[model samples]
Target: MDRIRDLASKKAAVIFTKSSCCMCYSIKQLFYELGASPAVHELDKEARGREMELALRGLGCSPTVPAVFIGGVYVGSATDIISLHVDGSLKQMLINAKAIWF
Candidate 1:
């Protein structure tokens, strides 16, 4: 738990993702299109993937793959991002988190 929290705060924006998940891919693509690079942790490819996933679940992000964090705050999953985008707030959130310059 401490390690996950530490890593989440290591960057202004962070994404815990899986390499082969389409949702994770979409999140990465969205950030790329926004010209922002989030610190991505690919759980499926890591030795401690299960442990981290459990930790994330306990932290309130169930189905934790592709979980997001901004400024050390948990920001939900891709669906949440899509909602934010629909409201035209995702960009501002990224900007607020210092994930993008514009």
Candidate 2:
């Protein structure tokens, strides 16, 4: 409860993924390159994995691997993430998520 809420409230981004998920690997690589240690929740083994899946689905995203959330906002799938990066919005998103900018 509190732990989950705390995790959801962190300034850093959160990426919920399952093992052997290629998109998850890609997103992790990209975020690591950007010097951000995004919190990773492995849905496949998480206690409330199914609840998280339902939540993502309710937010209009697929209940699949690599569901991303930034600053408590759902950011959709891998394609959406890559699109954000390609369009040069990822950094701004990080800044906004962290509430810090240089």
Highest TM-score, which number? Answer: 1
Q: Give the per-residue lDDT digits (tens) of candidate 2, residues 8-96.
A: 56756888788778888999889888777788888778898777766656667774668777887778789999999999898789887
The number of clashing residue pairs in model 2 is 0
lDDT of prediction 1: 0.89
Worst ten in a row by lDDT for model 1: 62-71
RMSD of 1: 0.9
Note the clash tally of each candidate.
0, 0
Q: Which parts of model 1 are misplaced by more than 4 Å?
A: none
Give the per-residue Cα lDDT of candidate 1 at 57: 91
- Runs off by more than 4 Å, candidate 2: 1-7, 99-102
The TM-score of candidate 2 is 0.81
Deviation in Å, model 2, residue 47 alpha carbon: 1.9
Checking candidate 2 for backbone clashes, the offending pairs are none
| lDDT at position 67, candidate 1 | 95
Candidate-wise lDDT, in order:
0.89, 0.77
